[model samples]
Target: MARTRTLLTAGAFALVTALLPTITTVGAAAADRDGPGPVAVSESRGQLTVTVPPGHGGPGYRLLIDEKTLGVRTVRAGRTVLATNPAGGFAFGDQHATSVTTWSYAAGTLRIAAASTAPADTVAVAITPTADRYDLTWSVAGAPAGARTVSYQLSSAGHWYGGGETSEGAAQPYPLDAGQVSEPDFSPASYLMMEPYWYTSSSVGNYVRTASPMDVQINKSASGLGDFTIKSTDSYASTVFVESTPSAVYQDYVEVVGKPSKSDATPAEIAQPLWNSWAQFYTAIDQNKVLDWAGKLHAAGLGGHTIQLDDKWESNYGNLTFDPKTFPNPKAMSDQIHSMGYHFGLWTTLWINLDSANYAYAKDHGYLLAAAADSTKPCTVTWWNGTAGIIDLGKPAARDWYTGNLHQLMSTYGVDGFKFDTRFFDDSCAPAAGVQAGDYQRLGAEMADGFDLQGAGVRVHWGNQKYGFVIRAVDAGTSFPELRTTLRRSMAISTDGYPFVETDMIGGSLGEPAPTKQVLVRWAQAASLMPLMYSSTSPLGVVDHTTGKPVTYDPETVQLYKNAIARHGRLSDYLQAQARKSVADGTPIIRPVFFDFAADQRFYTTDDEWMLGPSVLAAPVLSDSPTRTIDLPAGAWFDTVTHRVITGPRTLSAYPAPLGVTPAFVRLGAPGAATAIAALSHQS
Candidate 1:
């Protein structure tokens, strides 16, 4: 009976195996016959295939990366849309080409030209191939009516990461079906960094090579492969880079777009942790309060080389003067801060309040952005504080005027630098004289050229990386979830090619409840591993609002804070070295874990962890629970807290993590690993 049962099971397996190949062959034959009408012109180079179908209703083309259809686009009278047939394959619908005008692959380039219907006279796509990568440029000549957008599609395979900065869902790859994503512009308030780039786990990368306003719209097909509809109001070019790993793809992107350029080396000040007065006082700051806070931080052995005064210090929003009411003698305060061995940095914004001293001067001289509704008057828009006019940084004279005030502050009051804030120039009051938003953002960074280190939002331009300021992570709240948000956004921004990353304050920002003792300690631990560790609320004096008194953290908790700061200080040299190297070759000092371990698929979707350059991996506990899991990449890793040697690709579950320590590891033989491990051990 047993032999009969075995024979029957083997016969059933043989029957299915015999039929599998026949079924697959039939499916392939059917798929091959489904074409996009008749191809008027076809060309192939490297791994790309360009097929142009003659345009009658519209001019369109389809690209296949190694025979896999990348996407299909058709331009009509008014709008352009990507067409996909019901069978999850490429199609042109009624936009099938009538004739091919120019079909030529000359001088290592493939150009396919076609004639379309009304509104669009002609449409063409030029492909420049290099190895496995392709530079795709499409031009739509004479579209006189609706939006003049540069529309194209990209493969949305595997997981997609990069649409500027957002704490919401940033730790995870982009949702394939999110439709139209929010905050698609270069607004730091909404999106901390607005970079026109994205990379997928499929080892594909895209960099929209335009300073114009561009929005990345993602739409996924029934099959996981999807579309990246780049809806730009202006014409632009883009590159689709392919490499063996995502890191290599990013390297190619930086080389093509242009690496960050400033001085030959990144300034050393970028690596130091600093204390600010925003969350600590919330604009209730005075000269005495500034000095007192600095003193308290010093006495507690917590403050770094910089003591920054945040919002509400200036008399008016854009006037750039100390408030005489709160800060009676600004110079004396600056001197006191300097005497305490700390750089005195003030918070500065580009908004000019209507009631400011310089409002009349700015409005009369056209230094402020003119209102689009009425060009004769300055554009007065509402912000967090109130209605104000934004300075036209796009204009040379206006930029000089703003920076002149900044220089005057430095010369008169011994101000070291500024923490530039509120950088977004919304569409309502923007491009007064047809200036692009990118121009304003670039000019803003250029203003910091002759100044000290200034923390600002990440700006993407040809050489804007040379601005020499740390890219600050978005401000977070005081809860465990917000702590996780800070990590997510910091990693996201760094991954976008802004290397020098600064995290939020040790605790949460204002309006949120004070961080709990455990939260504060954990936040400090996580921040300690980042490039810059900033603190606005000290762990020693977290306020218990219910009792109207300080929530005293135990000695152990205070020691944890000290250890975190000490760890950052000890690792400052290594961090600065990595930063300087980034200035040379556009590598990020703080990046996501998958960046270094791209071959390990286990970490492709991991977001809670990060890498410090190439040596250290930081997986700080970012939740209420102290225990966490860490997936170590391939190779031997030295555990900092436990002093244990672990091998990967391995995952440690329920790792013993307590409030006293951050979970970090050093790859055994990476550059500077020994020194880093020793310094971290000293802190422990």
Candidate 2:
């Protein structure tokens, strides 16, 4: 029998529906009227099953209209252990679980009881079903002594996209599924981003609602479907959102997290490119060097609005002042940067080197974290820079003092904002702080509220959406493969909800071997299509290390590079508009193509191509090949280069993308179609 009790809690779900004003349906399911409606529930011997229509069809579940599977689910519970150290290392002990003892469904919720060993006598789970999603919570009657691992079994098959940043070198073939992710082998490093949310191509999304260090693993069964095992240190609740399309699932998540806060970056900031000192000069940057780079950037007709001084700008790590030796007359440098029509951004971290002049004062004042071993002494941790004392941002006084120092620096030196840099967890000193790494990161970021803040070495959380600053890709090397890696990194991070995305420098960081002319031009073309195109290596000055001479692009390559920036400039308004919409809802400005075409499996593996808002699709060449194939999801696509409208589901094989051109298509009837098409036409 089917029960039709609505899942809208008097206050909780009512708020969710109000936030999600627009609900799009996928496949053949009946269009959801208003917000989500009641879900179907049925019970069997000792077990209960709830069904919500999936966005797409699958073989293992009950069929719905258009052959779509009604996603079925059952919950289970287990136990595990979490250990962390000062070196930002974490380990999880072996895990064990118990089967469901009994289950009952009533008033839109399914409750399951389970038996556990000592420390935890019993475990109870309550799953409340809504229109196309469910909220699951678990609790123990007795202390588990360790962590609890909750899991859900879904009879669906598809690739997984979210769940934080992709591990380094694991970028291609899109989704992290089956063979790509496994238990024990797939460790917390994969979850370093600490974003415990994942949405799949099958239109199922899982969000582990806990800040505690947790491990999320997805593995395919022999039958092709998969299991989501989320182990957290504390008993917690998680939500499972099902929709007809991945985009709807993402929107549902955004509603829960709330829209981007007003403090997010301004429209002008979103539209302009950022130039950083790290990629070009690294720690060797000086006052004169910055000015020279700014002049060179201007001469190239690249009006980058922000020039960031990355690592080594500070007199010492966490000192929050310019190094006098490298940046003599810091105030004058800031004024010159501002006079040149740019925002001066300084890099910062919480690590205060013991050698720093202010270290003793901070330690004496209770601003520094105490060593875990000796509460009387300040903690010392070694990092790339050196061993340093970390500021205890968890303390309100410490945060206020830190904020005041930055404000003083900015006011005295004409600094417009800061690029906050620090590992998500850095406790080389084994600090005895009670604050989790994620909390500390959020607190540190909050101190930069209202400033032109950007995150480099930080974690991405849904709550931080309000900060509205750009989150950049990790450093990239100067290789064609690395260029592709940069693209995958952006797509992964963007889909994880850092909407205002920025790529590293044009030709990769200067730390690696210089890119050849071809690689540099190709990288420039690809980065131009992202939300923010960052450049550091001077287009006119980068030396070709292989030849020991300036990397000189031919007329075609040069034109292609210039054309990329021109196209980006022309579409700036469209990008800004999409960014605003993302703030209003929870959608990303630059996202995987699957977000729109989830029913089409062909796009599930797409990593190189991306959708810039709804109107434009960019297919930048990411390899050394002179030509590449292009796959267009169902749509009326207007090819920018040929000026022809090609209807697809169609595949354009061996698309002629010469040295100086990238393939981009503008959807004919999307909201910003006219503006995007016009931009492409102007570029062509």
Q: What's the lDDT for candidate 1?
A: 0.63
lDDT of 2 at 487: 76
**Model 1 lDDT tens row, 404-485:** 8989999999998777776546556656465665566566666655566544333333235555457776677778877876
Where's the lowest-lDDT run of ten residues in candidate 2?
A: 79-88
Clashing pairs in 1: 54-97, 54-98, 55-97, 55-98, 56-98, 261-466
Model 1 stretches astray by more than 4 angstroms: 1-103, 113-122, 145-156, 167-180, 184-191, 219-236, 262-271, 430-437, 454-463, 542-552
Total clashing pairs in model 2: 6
TM-scores for every candidate against the unseen true structure: 0.80, 0.82
